[model samples]
Every structure is written in structure tokens, then in C-alpha cells.
Target: MTKKFYTVSARYWSTLDSVEIVQDGEKSAKFNASVITAPAEYSFHCQLVGTDDLYPAKLIPNDDEAEKWDVLISSFQIQGFNIENNQFSYASDCTSFFTPGIWMGLVTSIILLWILTYGIHMIMQLTTNSRFDDPKGPALSVPQTE
Candidate 1:
């Protein structure tokens, strides 16, 4: 009987989110999240890539080594917020509140304020026009009859 061995290679990449790896196998590795923060006006995504193959032989043999080789891949997305030492740590979901929500709220408030001011101005203008006469226009005159 011949002893067979296999090798595995894994890589993970993310734009704004974090990744946590959990393995219950003989070979395992740990990785850190990317440093890029989420965008203020849009949502972002994360990606993972993993590859595995049999060792020694460049191509996997169908004879017996194929049956011995096994690959397991697992991934998880972490969410929520944490604050420590006066520093803030935000996950993908948590960061969204600061980015999209804040800007949306700001824009909505500004639009509402403009609409309210315009409505008030229109009302005041109507009242003034009804109460006062135009000073620059000619007055009404009647011809005197003999």
C-alpha cells in the first residue's frame, strides 16, 4: 500500500467587509480582514477563493489517491459593532448606518426644509398681494361729462 498526500491553498479578499475562518481539520490557517472601509453612498461586497489538489502528482489520479483526498471550505460574514479604548470598530452592517443612513437623513432633511420654506414664502406673498395695492401701476380714472 502507498501513502498519499494532498495540499490545499486558500485565499480571501474583501473590499469593505471582514471574514472569519473556522476549521476543524488537520491543516488550518488564520487571516485578518481588509483595511478598506465601506463607501458612504453604496454597499460593498467581499470575496473568497480556495484551491486544493493532490500532492506529488501534478494531476489527480483516479486510481486510489482521488478517494483519499478531501477538501472542506467554510466562510462566514461578521456583523455588528464594537468599541474599545475610545476607538470604534464597525462591521459591514454597522458601518452602513454611519454612511448611507446619515447621508440619506441629511439629504431628506434639507429637501423637507426647502419645501417648508417655499410653502411659507408663497403663503406670505399671497397675503401681501391681497392686502396692498400696486404702487407703480396707473390708477383708475373716469371721464367728466358736461
Candidate 2:
């Protein structure tokens, strides 16, 4: 089977406020549920490009009745901070706090590599002058000798 690629994949986190079951005149929904976190949740929902079988219909908590509703603590991601009910925070530059030496070592190694490459190039030019020709340029005037 071939795997399809998604152009966008995003994660959302929200605490559901409530769930409810609404009964019409005759028909009823067994697996009916509404999702509620906060107003920010909708903005994240708006970014979703595709849909499962049950979408385009907003899932909201049934704020009227209480007995007919069931809350499922499934690990589904939602959009925005549910800070009215929970806390999710983010901060930048965490790597500097944890591993400063790793970044510094990477920079030092890159500089050392450039110096070694230049030295090797000069050594090769001096050793392989079998044709006995002195190329004219500022490079030749550098006077590199043992």
C-alpha cells in the first residue's frame, strides 16, 4: 500500500467543557457528543483542511440537559489554550539553557575545518609543481616555505 502525504499536520489541545445528548421528536443519536474548550479552539479548528466522516458540523457541549451526556477522555488534539480550564504554555531558547557547549563546539569545529582545508591546498600546490611553472598572482607572493 502507498502512503499519502498531508500538506499540513497540526496538533491541538483543549479540555472539553461538556457533552450532551439532544433528542428530537422521534430520532436519537447514541454517539452524539459536542466538544468545548474555549473560543480559541474554533480558530484552530478553522485551519483544518480535510475532514473525517463527521465534520463541518461543529461539536459543542449540550449546555441544556445533563443526564443524557457522556464525556470521553480520548486523546484527540484541539486548537488553542484551554486556560479557562487548563494550562498550556510555550517558551523559546530552551536549548541555550540545556546545552551551551554543544552549540559552541559545532561553531569551533567549522572554523577549524576551514583552516585545515586552506593549509592542505597550499601544501598540495607546493608539492605538485612538476612542470616547474610559478603561477603569477598574489597567491604566489604569499611566500609559504618550510
Q: Report the number of the highest-TM-score candidate.
A: 1
Candidate 2, backbone clash total? 2
Q: Candidate 2 residues 21-99, lDDT tens each?
A: 4467653333332332323333222222112333432344333343244333333344444334464333111112435
**Which residue runs of candidate 2 sit more than 4 Å off their true CA positions?**
1-8, 13-98, 128-146
Per-residue C-alpha lDDT of model 1 across residues 116-146, encoded as one tens digit per residue: 9999999887733223445797764544561
Candidates in order have lDDT scores of 0.39, 0.40
**After TM-score superposition, what is the CA distance of residue 42 in candidate 1 from its true location, in Å?**
28
- Per-model TM-score on C-alpha atoms: 0.29, 0.26
Model 1 gets an lDDT of: 0.39
The alpha-carbon RMSD values of the candidates against the true structure, listed in the order shown, are 15.9, 16.0
